[model samples]
Target: MLKKTRVAVFVSGGGSNLEALLQSEVSGGMPFGEIALVVSNTQGAYALERANNHGVEGVCIPSRGNSGFEEELQALLMARHIDIIVLAGFLAILSADFVGKWPERIINIHPSLIPSFCGKGFYGLKVHEAALERGVTLTGATVHLVNEIPDGGRILLQKAVEIRPDDTAKTLQQRVMEQAEWVLLPQATAQLCQELSEKLSEGV
Candidate 1:
């Protein structure tokens, strides 16, 4: 049997990617051990409901714009002994101290390929809108390690989607999610877990 690695998924929105991850695990497509928890910074996030449907423990720890929020987050992570953190639509900017502790263990899915249509002020439909404005035929999603430098983390995987000539931002966003984000996030996560497993066996 493969040793289970506890995964904690963070989300701040609808959590389509989170749903993908959960479904992947349920269908035996995910190589990781299990999704131990789902944490959302927003109280009303639909992602929490999805977690409940799967019988996974979901918690909403609202960001209070104070040190208390960080303390609560750190406590939850430590308590669960989480092995990996998957940021599925999570928008909160983690503190430098938090990133320092987890390092490459945290991974995030970005709407657009990194180094383009990413970084500050580029999120949600804005990413797709920017791609269309630039007249780019190809735009996609990127899965990367999470660091303090916004989307500057090392890229793990990127999958491109073709942008239709008459596509609106919403339409393009859906295509990218269907073709890239949903497919690549789980794959990258499985690969990361496999690498971690090998490292463990090698005593790294």
Candidate 2:
């Protein structure tokens, strides 16, 4: 069997994206990769529960208001031999040291087409609100590499969802997830993992 690329998903909320990824992995929809770990910065996050239900190891490593959180997180990821890190609603800003250590190995899924309703302070419902405020006919989700800056990375994939006239921020959020985010995230993950696996086979 080909060696599967191990992925660690980080989250700070309910982890619906993580759930999609897990389902994809088990259904053989996400070829070349497996979810090895789920990490949450907040103990109250329900994402951790979803991870356990999926039979994946999940842990809570609170930030504790310091850089120590990154150190502990790094150790845990390394111990699990994680190859890719996906930020699925993870709220903490990654330190420069952590970004440097991971480089392009880290990625995130944003609620809107990046550079549109994205950047710092554009997450969760705020992104959809911004799109609605701007009266854009179409808004969608983006999967991109995670960098030192928030939501300012090379775009890997994007899928658009039309903004209905009657949509509220909450409704728009659900539409984006169902129509775009859920679809693009797993596709991007599989694409990235396949590329990584091929590169490894080539000894690159």
For every candidate, C-alpha RMSD to the true structure in Å = 1.3, 1.1
CA error at residue 138 for candidate 1, angstroms: 0.7
Report the lDDT of model 2 for residue 95: 84
Candidate 1 at residue 68, lDDT? Answer: 85
Residues 74-184, model 2: lDDT tens digits: 999999999999999898989878998988899999999878988888889999888999999999999999888888889999988999999999999999999998998
lDDT accuracy of residue 144 in candidate 2: 97
Collision pairs in model 2: none
Please give, for residues 41-84, the per-residue lDDT of candidate 1 as tens digits.
99899999999999999999998565588788879989998888
List TM-score per model, in order: 0.95, 0.96
How many residue pairs clash (N, CA or C atoms closer than 3 angstroms) in each of the candidate models, in the order given? 0, 0
| Runs in model 2 lying further than 4 Å from the true structure | none
Best of the candidates, lDDT:
2
